[model samples]
Target: MTQTPTPATPVHWKVVIDTADPHAQADFWAAALRYVVEDNSALIGNLLGAGAVPAELVVESHGRRAWRDLVAVRHPDDPYDEASGTGRGRRLLFQRVPEPKTVKNRLHLDLHPGEGRREEELARLEDLGARVLRRVEEPSGGWIVMTDPEGNEFCLH
Candidate 1:
């Protein structure tokens, strides 16, 4: 007799992006996807008051205190920490880097726009500083390949 194997427990995952400017990328992506940028102001404030974080490492974002070297955005519909203002689902974390991107991304995001709104969404993203890299087609499917202002590749399917 043949038997199916038991499914493994799902593990949590987060997408990490390398960038010279994390804040800018976070802003662009947040607007493009209608996601809310995570507000760690309370945490930052506490750290600052305790002297755990240097004052120079903080910045004013959305009229609140935040870390200067990192930021994250998440789906607006997802559950978030009220005190810290961080999303619990579909989050994108941006961290600063000293060097610029010089190679193709081995991993990228594929956006399924759904139905006939691909062009419209693409246009809107372009207006938000995304550049069209190319249009690709295959026997099985097709999509518009684009890059963010910082040149990180993503697609509109």
Candidate 2:
């Protein structure tokens, strides 16, 4: 008899980004990706009521309570924990950093908006405060590099 190996469990993860303004980054990313910003007001309220969280550590975002140093955005259709408003799938967490971004990103997001809709999507992103850095044309295909409001680099292909 031969034994079949069991598949490994998938790891859960969220991309952590350093930003000078986490709330603004969260808003920009949420709009750019058509995702929803996670709201943790209920959890914060519970913690505050229990004296488990400091009031100064929280801030009002979208008129709701959120962590002052961090914010996240998640795919609208992804499963989330109702108690904490945290996503179980694709998500991005932006954390506050004291210093500004002064160099190119070592890793960046690459967006695919479909075959021929790249230009349309690019225009929409520009309207959302993204500026085109440059356009790249290669033998394989082409893409447009862009910088977000705070200057983080990303590409549209």
Candidate 3:
């Protein structure tokens, strides 16, 4: 008798982006994706109290203490670590980088608003500090390329 192989489980992850301002990037992305910014204040407080991290390494964002170099946004319906406010599902993490973006991205995100709301969604995103880079139309479909406030590219379809 032959036995079928078991399927492997998928790994959990969050996309990490390098940026000049983590908090600002987090804010923009949170609003754009309808995600919530991860609130790690409780854990930050504990770490501060224990002297595990210095106060100089933290900053206030959205009225909460956040890492000066890192912030994240997560899907609203996903579960997270209560102690650290870390998302266990779909998420994006932004970390501070010394240099600005110098070239086109090797990877980017594509968003689909629905069957007939692309224009509305594009406008909404633009109001949130996204700049339209170009519009592309092809035999298969059409899309608009945009860059975030910090110049990270994403597409609206």
Report the alpha-carbon TM-score of model 3 versus the true structure.
0.94
Cα-based lDDT at residue 113, candidate 2:
91
Root-mean-square deviation per candidate: 3.4, 1.6, 1.9
Window of ten residues with lowest summed lDDT in model 2: 2-11
Which stretch of 10 consecutive residues in model 3 shows the poorest summed lDDT? Answer: 5-14
Better of 1 and 3 by lDDT: 3
lDDT of 1 by residue, 73-92 (tens): 99988888887777778999
Model 2 stretches with alpha carbons more than 4 Å out: 1-6
How much does candidate 1 score in TM-score? 0.91
TM-score of 2: 0.95
Show pairs that collide, candidate 2: none
Tell me how many residue pairs clash in candidate 3: 0
- Per-model TM-score, in order, reads 0.91, 0.95, 0.94
Residue pairs with clashing backbones, model 3: none
Model 1 misplaced regions, further than 4 Å: 1-9
Candidate number with greatest TM-score: 2
Candidate 1 lowest-lDDT run of ten = 9-18
Instruction: Rate residue 86 of model 2 by lDDT.
Output: 90
Model 3: per-residue Cα lDDT at residue 130: 99
